[model samples]
Target: MDILVCVKRVPDTSTNEIEVNDAGTDIERDDLVYSINEWDNYAVEEALQIVDRVGGSVTVAAVGDDESDEVLRRAMAMGVENAMLLSGDAFAGLDGRGVATVLQAAAKTKGIDLILTGAQADDGCAQVGGMLAAMLDQPFASLVNMIEVESDKTLKIGREVEGGEQEISRIELPCVLSIQTGINEPRYVGVRGIRKVASVEIPTMDAAALGLTAEALAPQVERLDYFTPEVGAGAEMLEGSTEEMVAKLIEMLQAKGGMK
Candidate 1:
């Protein structure tokens, strides 16, 4: 089995550098530090585990600018056999559909037998995996917590559904899966692996290489501006007797429209 795990480089949410610009349409990446999207690390780990058990190869793929190579190398250092970067100036400003189009083309070139991705990227759009699956015309399952490869052609999986219920699904191979973060704990790169793949070059592909054009990959949805939400101080507490405090709390809630 050839497992292709899609990864992404995103601004570290903890850095507090992700902010909307004055226009309120897109995040400003200036002065931001980048890391592999946290959830995608779990997906990569899951792929590595599968290949370890099943005697296959794992390839990590990403769509981004030249800077994305660092994240791909990180995955390679963690034991991925190959890393691919689908990037170009034309790929800039792509939305989910454009991303899926490029990724689908790349996956086809790799002759992938299985596709895995984080249920959602931490930028939090939460739509790429499903969109990619749709573009590939493959069956897909989301929120997967556990996966069992029954054979070269089948998978038995466990997913979490609403109301805390666990659903078991038997999906065919050549499908896509969006793994939930808690599906497995991602492992750290060891010194040996890190040093071994540190200088490994990540192969790059572009829209033109994939026989795609900018118009075809252009975003259906456009970002018009970027802005952050306004911040304000918390409410003042009124010190009083228990009964009086309750009355005051109700008054505050009512004033804030929390109470009808």
Candidate 2:
């Protein structure tokens, strides 16, 4: 059950505001702290958990520049067998599809049997898993919560859907699965563990190494414009007793066509 897990470094915005950069096409990342995207951590951990059960290795990969190695080291520290950096200056400003393009090239060299990724990046464009599946011409399932790799080279998986229901299926291996969180609790890496692997080098492959050219890797989608929204007035507070509030609410609703 050799696994390849793809992770991304996303801004840790839980404690910080995401400010649009002066260029407006993206955020100001220079001063922001980055961490493995929350869902992707689950993907990494899920891969580790699977291989731990069936006896195999988990290779982690990421698409980014040199600064991207932080998350890869963290994944290795969590006990991944190896890490690869799919990087190039040409990869800058690429969209999710472009990222998938590079990742597919790198993945081909790794001899992966199972591929895992978060259902969606925390930064929120959920396009990579499906796109990569298409690029590799492999079967894909998204939002999977449970997995059972069978002896016959197929997997029985349970996918999460709305209203707490689950969809189950049996799919062949060499498939792509976009993992959903709560599938498993990600492990915690102590500072010592991180530091122990801190100096370990992760091999990187640039676009050329992956047989990619600048033209083949350009973003298919273009960002036309970006703007910071003007601050608006605060909401009106309805005051008084419950009855008064209900009456006021009814009046407003009637005025707004929400009620007759």
Candidate with top TM-score is: 2
TM-score of 2: 0.92
lDDT tens digits by residue: candidate 2, 1-260: 88999999888879668888898877776878888888899999999888877888999999988888999999999999799998878888888889899889988997789899899985577889999999999999999999887853899999999999999999988999999989999999989889999999899999889999888788888877667889999998999999999999999999999998
* Runs in model 1 lying further than 4 Å from the true structure: 190-192, 231-260
TM-score of 1: 0.88
Residue 130 in candidate 2, Cα distance off native in Å? 0.7
Structural similarity to truth (TM-score) of each candidate = 0.88, 0.92
lDDT of 2 at 49: 85
lDDT of each: 0.88, 0.89
